[model samples]
Target chain A: MLERVRIVLVNTSLPANIGAAARAMKTMGLAQMVLVAPKIFPSPEADTLSSGATDILAQARVVSSLDEAIAGCRLVIGTSARSRHIPWPLLNPRAAAAQAWAELPVGEVALVFGREDRGLTNDELHKCHYHVHIPTNPDFSSLNLAAAVQVLAYEMRMRSLEDDQVEAPFWGVDWDIDAAPAEDIERLFVHLEQVLVKVDFLDPENPRQLMTRLRRLFLRSRLDTVELNVLRGFLTAIEKSSKQ
Target chain B: MLERVRIVLVNTSLPANIGAAARAMKTMGLAQMVLVAPKIFPSPEADTLSSGATDILAQARVVSSLDEAIAGCRLVIGTSARSRHIPWPLLNPRAAAAQAWAELPVGEVALVFGREDRGLTNDELHKCHYHVHIPTNPDFSSLNLAAAVQVLAYEMRMRSLEDDQVEAPFWGVDWDIDAAPAEDIERLFVHLEQVLVKVDFLDPENPRQLMTRLRRLFLRSRLDTVELNVLRGFLTAIEKSSKQ
Candidate 1:
C-alpha cells in the first residue's frame, strides 16, 4: 500500500534537501520519489546527507514538469504552507494519509512538496485533489523541506500501521503478567487498608479520604497480577514487622 | 501550554543538527529547548541551517547533564529506537503528544532525544516515565536528529490545534493539586526502597527490577502533590513500625 504512494518534489533548490527527503521517505517505508525541475541532483552533497538511504535517491525519477510527476497518480495531494483563496479541500497530514490510503486501492497517489522558499504555485495547487497543510506556528511557518517530508511520511506510516492492526490493543495487557481481576484488586485494597491501619498510617476511626485517593490512583494504573502480588507481599511484610 | 513542554537533546554531535532541531521546534510552536552537553554550540553551521529560527538557538538552554536538563519536568518521555526486553509503556508520536498534553496542566513535560550516533543510552531511557518510538521502517529506521524532532513537534502542533478547536477543554486546570514534580517522585522512590528493604519485602542485595516495576506503575498514574505526600507518609509509617 505504501509503495503505491510517490513523494513529489517540485523545483527544489538544494540537492542536499532532496537527498535528505529521500532518507526521510525511506525511513517511513516510502519508496518512489519524483523530482520535478530540481536545481541540482546527482550531487555528492545529496548522497552525503542521504546517509544510508541512497537507494531512494538512486531510483528517484527526475521530470521536467509537475504534470509529468502527477501524470499517472489517481490522487494528488499538494502540501500548502499558506492558505490560498481558492477554497479547495484542505486536510492535515493525518487526514491526507487516510485519503491517500483510501485512493491507493484503485491507483497511484502523489504527495507533492513545493520549493523551499515558496510552496507550490497557485496553478500547481489547483492541480491537486486536496491541499494538505501541516499546522505550523503562524509567525514562523516556514518548515524545512525534508522536515515537511518527514512529517507527511510519518503520518503515512502511522496510518498504514493502524490499518494493519486487528484492533486497538489495550496497553499494559501485553506484559508478562495478566491484569489483576476485580476480586484480586478488592482483596489487595482490603489488605492494604488493614496494613495501613496497623502501621498507624491511617486511623481506622477516621481515614479522611486517604484510602479513596490511593484507590483512585491505583485503579487508573490498572495494576497487573505481579504488581498486585508485590503489593500484597509488601503489606504482609509490613504487618509482620508491626507485630514484631 | 506548549511553552511548558520542552524538547531536550542530549550529547548532540553536530551543531547543524541542533540548529535544525531549533527550527523544527519553533515551527511547531514549541519554544523551550534544553541541550545536554552538545559537542559544539554557537556555530555558524547551526545558525545557517536554522535559517530564520536563530532566536530559538539563542534562547536554548545548554545544560551539563540530562538530570539538569529535565530538572523540574514532571513527565519525561524518551525517544527509543529499539524494543528492549523489559515491557515498558511505549507510545507512538500521536499518543505521546496526547500524553504530553494531559500532563501539561500540572507542570513541565520533557521529550528527550539522545545522541546522534547511538541514540539514548539504556540508562537514559530507563529515566523516562514513558518511551515514545517513531514507527519507522525497520530496514531503514535511522532518522536524522532534526527529522525526528520535526515529526514529534508536528504531532504536538496537531494536538494543540485539535484542542483549540474544541468548545470545552479535554482536562481542566482547576484541580486542587498539581502533579508531583520529578524531584518529589525521585524522593518517593528512595523512601520506597528504604521501607521495602526494612520490611524484608525487597532484598537490597538482589532487588531484581522490583523498584523499576513499581516506578513504572506509579509514574503512569501521574500522582498529584497530595497523593505523593500521602504515599510518603505511609512509607514513613511503615519504617517506624519496622524499627519498633
Candidate 2:
C-alpha cells in the first residue's frame, strides 16, 4: 500500500528540504518521491541532510511540471495551508490519507507538496483530487516544507497499517459518483465567477473573499464532474438572462 | 485559562529555537514563558526568528532552575517523546493540553520542554505529573524543538475552544481550595522524600521511581496547602515509627 503512494514536491527551492523530506518519507516506510521542477537535486546538501535515508533521495524522480510528476497516479492529494484565495475539496491529513488510500487497492496515489515561500499556484492546485490541511498554530502556520511532508507521510503510513478500511462519509448524493479532477472544478470556478461579475452580482475589482467563500461552500459539496457541468450551465443561464 | 499556562524550556541550546518557540506560543494565544538555564539568551537571532512575537521574548522570565521556572505553578507537564529510561504518566499533546489547562481556573501550570537533543532527563521527568508525547515518524522521530512546541501550543489553542468542562472527572475534595504553589509543593517533596528515606520505605541511593511514583499519585490528588501538610504529617509519623 505504501509502495503505491508517491510524494510530489512542487518547485522546491531548497536542496536541504528535499533531503529532509526524503528522510522523513523513508522513516515512514514511504519510498516513492517525485520532484516537480526542484531548483537543485543530486547536490551535496541534500545528501548530507538525508542522514541515513539517502537511498530515498538518491532515487527521487525529478520532473519539470506537476502534471508530469503524478502522471500514473489515480488520486492526487495536495497539502495546503488553507490559502485565502479559494477553498477546494479540503480534508485534514488523516481523512485525506483515508480517502486517497481507499483507492490504494485500485492504483497509485500522489501527495503533492508546494514550495517553501509560495505554496502551489491556484492553477497547479487545480490538478489535485483533494487538499490536505495540517492543523497548525495559525500564527506560525507556515511550517517548514519537510515538517509538512513528515506529517502527511506519517498519516499515510498509519492509515496503511490499520486493518479497517473505513471510508469517509460521502459529502452528498449527486449525479456524478466519480469526483471531478481539479481541472473541471477550476473551470467551474472560472465560469461561475465570470457569470457572477457579468450579472452584476459580484464586482471583479476589489473581489474580496467573495469568491473564496463561494469556493468553500462549493468545495464542501464535493462537486462531481456532472455537478460541475450543471453549475457551469447555471452560470451560462445567468449570463444569458442578464444580457437580455 | 490561557494566562495560567506557562511554557518552560530547560537548558535550551539554541536561541533561535527559543524565539521560534515563543512565536509558536503567541500564535496559540499563550503568553507566559519561562526559560530555565538557557545556554544563550537575549539573542538577536531569537528576536529575528520570533518575527512579530518579540514582545513575548522581551517580557519572558529567566530562572536558574526548573523549580524556579515553575515556582508558582500548581501543575507541571513535561513534553518528552517518552524518555527511554522510565514510563511516566504519559499524555499525548491533546490530553496534556486538557490536563494542564484544567488547573488554570485556580492556579498556574507549567509546560516544560527539555534540551533539544535529549528531551527531559529522567529526574526532570519525575517532577512532572504527566509527559506529553507528540506522535511522529518513529524512524526519524526527532522533531525540531520549536516544531514540537508549535504542535503542543496548537493543541492548547484548540482545546481552549472546546466548551466542555462538565465532562471532566473531578480531581479531589477540598474547601475553597487554592492549590499550593510549586515552591511549597517542591518543599513538601523534599520533606516527604527525606522522611520516607529515613523510614526505610525509600532508598535515596538508586531510588528508582519510588518517589517519582509517589509524586504522581499526590500530584493527581491536586493537593491544597492543607492536604500537603497532612501528607507531610503522615510521612513524619512514618519517620517517627521507624526511629522508635
Candidate 3:
C-alpha cells in the first residue's frame, strides 16, 4: 500500500526540503518520491538533509508538471494547511488515508505537495480527488513541507497497520456484556447539562465556554455504547430524584 | 484540567526549544510551565522563539529536581521516544491526557520531558505513574523536544475543547457519574494473567514475549470495567474447563 502511494513535490524551491521530505517519507515506510520541477536536486544540501535516506532521492521521479506526475494515479490527494473557500471534500490526514486505502485501484496514488512560499494553486488542487488538511495551530500554521509529508505518511502507515487482520471479540449469550450505545451516551450529556443548569453550575447567559469544556471531557473518555447507556441511566435516576 | 497540567522540561539545553514549548502549551490552553535545572532561563533566544507566548514563560516555575516539580501531582506522565524495561503503563498522548484529566486530584499534574541527548533516566521515569510514548517513525525517532511537547499539548487542548459544555452534544448528563475504578481494572489484569499462565498461553519456564505483547495489546484497548469483567469471565471459564 505504501509502495502505491507517491509523494509528489511540485515546484519545490529548496533542495533541503526535498531531501527532508525523502527522509520523512522513508522514516514512515514510504519510499516513492516524485519531484516536479524542483529548483535544485542531486545537490549536496539535499543529500545532507536526507540523512540516511539517499535511496529515495536516487529513485525519485523528477517530472515537469503536476499532471504528468499524477497521470497514472487513481487516487489524488492535495496537502494543504489552510482551508479553501471552494470546498473540495476536505478530510483530515487520517480520514483521507483511510479513504484512499479503501478505494485504492490498480494505478498509483499521488499525494501532491506544493512549493514552500505558497501551497498548491486552486487549479492544481482541483485535479486532486480530495484535500487533506493537517490540523495545525491556527495562528502559526507554517508546517514545513517535510513535516507535512511526515504526518501524511505516518497516518497512512498507521491506517495500513489497522487493516491487518485482528479478531474482534465474540458477541453472544455466552459472554455477559453490559455496555451502553452511542445514542444513550449522547442523551446522558444532554441530561447532565440540564442538571448543571438547574443547579446554576452552568450560567445560562454565559454558558458557551463551560459547555464546550464539558463536551471535551466526555469526548476524551471515548465512551463505548454500553458505557454510554450506564451513564445515561445514572443521570436519569438523578434527574428523577431532583424532581422530588 | 488544563490548569492542573504542568509541562516540565528537565536539564533543557536549548533556549529556543523552551520558547517553542511555551508556544505549544499556550496554543493548547495549557499554562503551567516548569523548568527543571535548565542550562539557561529568561534568555533572549527563548523570548524570540516563544513568539507571543512570553506570558507562559513569565509565570514559569523553575525547579531543581523532577521529584520537587511533581511533588503534589497524583498522576505523573513521562514522555519518551524509546521503550524501557518495566514499562510504566504505556499510553499514547490522547489516552494519557484523558487518563490524567480524569484521575488527577486537585494538585499539579507533571508532564516531564527529558534532556535533548539522553532523555530521562530510568530513576526519573520511575516517579511517573505512566509513560507516554509518542509513536514516531521507529527508524528516526529524534523528534525535537518542543515538537513533541506541541503534539501532546495539542491533544490535551483538543480533548479539553470537547469537554466544553455549550457545544457538547450530550450536555444534559452529569459528568460525576460513577466510573468503574482503575484499581478494579488493574486487579482484573492480574486475574487474567494468572488464568493465561494456567492455560499455558503464558509459559513460566521459557516465556517468549507472549505476555508482554498481550499486555501491550490489552493496555492499548484501554479496557473499562465492563470489558474487563467480560474478559475475566472468559478466563474463568477456560480455567474451569481445564480443571474438568
Model 3 regions more than 4 Å off: A13-16, A42-51, A104-107, A163-244, B1-5, B19-32, B40-61, B101-108, B157-244
Candidate 2's C-alpha runs over 4 A off are A1-4, A23-30, A48-51, A83-86, A101-107, A135-140, A154-244, B1-4, B26-29, B101-107, B158-244
Candidate topping TM-score: 1
Overall lDDT per candidate, in order of appearance: 0.81, 0.71, 0.69
Q: Mind giving the per-residue lDDT tens digits that candidate 2 earns over B1-244?
A: 6756788999999998898788777766788889999999989999987757888899999989876776555456788774554454566666677766655665577889999788888656655655677655566675667767766776676678665322222333233655454345556778887887776777777887566555545544546777888887887777777853
> Which candidate, 2 or 3, would have the higher lDDT against the true structure?
2
Candidate 1 residue lDDT tens string, B1-244: 8988889999999999999998999999999999999999989999998888999899999999887887766567799985874545677888888878766765578899999899998667655666789999999998999999999898888888894432211111234566554456667888998888888899978977677667645644546679899999999888878863
DockQ of each: 0.13, 0.03, 0.03
What is the C-alpha local distance difference test score of candidate 2? 0.71
iRMSD, per candidate, in listed order: 19.7, 27.0, 19.5
> For candidate 3, what is the interface RMSD?
19.5
Q: Native-contact recovery for every candidate?
A: 0.34, 0.05, 0.03
State TM-scores per candidate. 0.69, 0.58, 0.58
Candidate 2: how many backbone clashes?
0
User: Which candidate number has the best lDDT?
Assistant: 1
Residue A230 shift from truth in candidate 2, angstroms: 72
**Local error of candidate 1 at residue A137 (angstroms):** 0.3
The complex in candidate 1 yields a DockQ of 0.13
Cα miss at A126, model 2 (Å)? 0.9
